[model samples]
Target: MATEHPAKARAPHRRPFQVATGVLGDLMFTTGVLLALLVAYSLWWTDVTVARHTGVAAEHLRQRWSAAAPAAPPTGTADTAVPPRFEADDGIGFLHVPAMGVGYQVLIKIGTGEDTLAEGVAGAYTNPYSSAMPWEPQGNFALAAHRDGHGAKFHDLDVLKPGDPLVVETRDRWYVYRVDATLPKTSKHDTGVIAPVPTGSPYTVPGRYITLTTCTPVYTSLYRMAVWGSLVREQPVDPDRTPPPELRKEDPSNG
Candidate 1:
């Protein structure tokens, strides 16, 4: 009776305690999520917007060309190559690279600025650098576009093998070029590849050339990847005649 039953003991309540680095860990995780979202926006959202802009640009070009075209005069048996007109705000021409893929085409624009290239079009080099126009008899018409994002116009450029047809369609002519060589890696500042003779190319003499350039390794810009081509023939625009056989062919890289 004097000593009652031993008093029952209760376990102590335990609660999680914040570590010294808990806040830092949370901050790091949040930053990672933001970066991922940015990438997704660049890769997906930009593509959707560029596609719409490209459609608009192509339509505007069609309308302008249609208005400028007069009743087809009898084109005599001669080189009826019409000079391509470049518009600062419109498409200059359309590129068709069959070896890259079937139904592959991209509009060529005037400037290589971020806004212009983001529209899913090839940008002609100008200012501090220049490129030969498609109508040029002997020069390099070098162009650049995105390889990984912002429409990725030249994503499949690396797939093009030598001799693949690279067609440039202007208002009144189709300048056909044949892929001569490709440079898988080169300095981004190397401007010689866009030269009239395109140094380091298979040919050293001046000739009608076209150089397609984009970032290399698919997703990084540490280096540039270039595809050089020589003008094979200039096909006069004809409503009756279909595209050249080279352009009509399926993806040669596949077969």
Candidate 2:
């Protein structure tokens, strides 16, 4: 008689929990990938687009300046400087911050609106308080830009310290400001930071000051950061469009 063969062993069945855990892991991995892509798009892709827009804007400004006539005779007295008022669509000048980077520069537009700053340029505040132009004899020239993404124009603003140079380049003149104080964090509702005489700053009287404001803590808009500067001096832009020594000086922060 032929020997009976042992019954074939059955394969173990997988528990429902095991299958559920595997599915959960796969979903988590997919979600992680999507989140990373979102961050990259927000930070990298946006910067790339902004840079292109910024280049076009700068080139147009250069052409306009070249075709335009020199600045007209001063209409206001020395104590009350009155430069030309440009429309918000027309940029007023360029900002140079050596402390921020070796060749850190951004266009300066009139209004500090979302659309304005989204162009990867610096914007002058116009609401609640109008910003004083760099040519103004006395008042605060408040400005704003994105601290992260959208070109991150003022990403290194926190690096600026007392005596750091911040230069504004107009068609005919260069307005140089010196960092005197900083508010690392403050409520976003604090409009006083951009006032003619910014509160919480060293200034106790009216003066020609510059305030650079941006969102604080990076990647978040919960608070605001401000860097206050005083108009240290002014220099005439030569035919060659040479920058001031402040702009040329090497900044240790660049390292």
Q: Show model 1 residue runs off by greater than 4 Å.
A: 1-18, 71-90, 251-255
Q: Write the per-residue lDDT of candidate 1 for residues 1-255, one digit (tens) a residue.
A: 465445433544444455536777899999999999999887988888888888888888867867775434425533444554556645778899877778888999888888888888999888446777887667888899998778888988889889788999877678889998999889999988888888789987888899999998877889998899999887676764357777766646534
TM-score of each candidate?
0.84, 0.87
On residues 120-187, what C-alpha lDDT tens digit does candidate 2 reach at each position?
Answer: 99999999999988877689999999988998998888998998989999887888899999999999
User: Model 1, residue 136: what's the lDDT?
Assistant: 69
lDDT of model 1, residue 227: 91
CA-only RMSD, every prediction: 4.9, 4.1
Candidate 2 vs. true structure, TM-score: 0.87
Which candidate leads the pack in lDDT? 2
Residue 49: error of model 1 in Å?
0.6
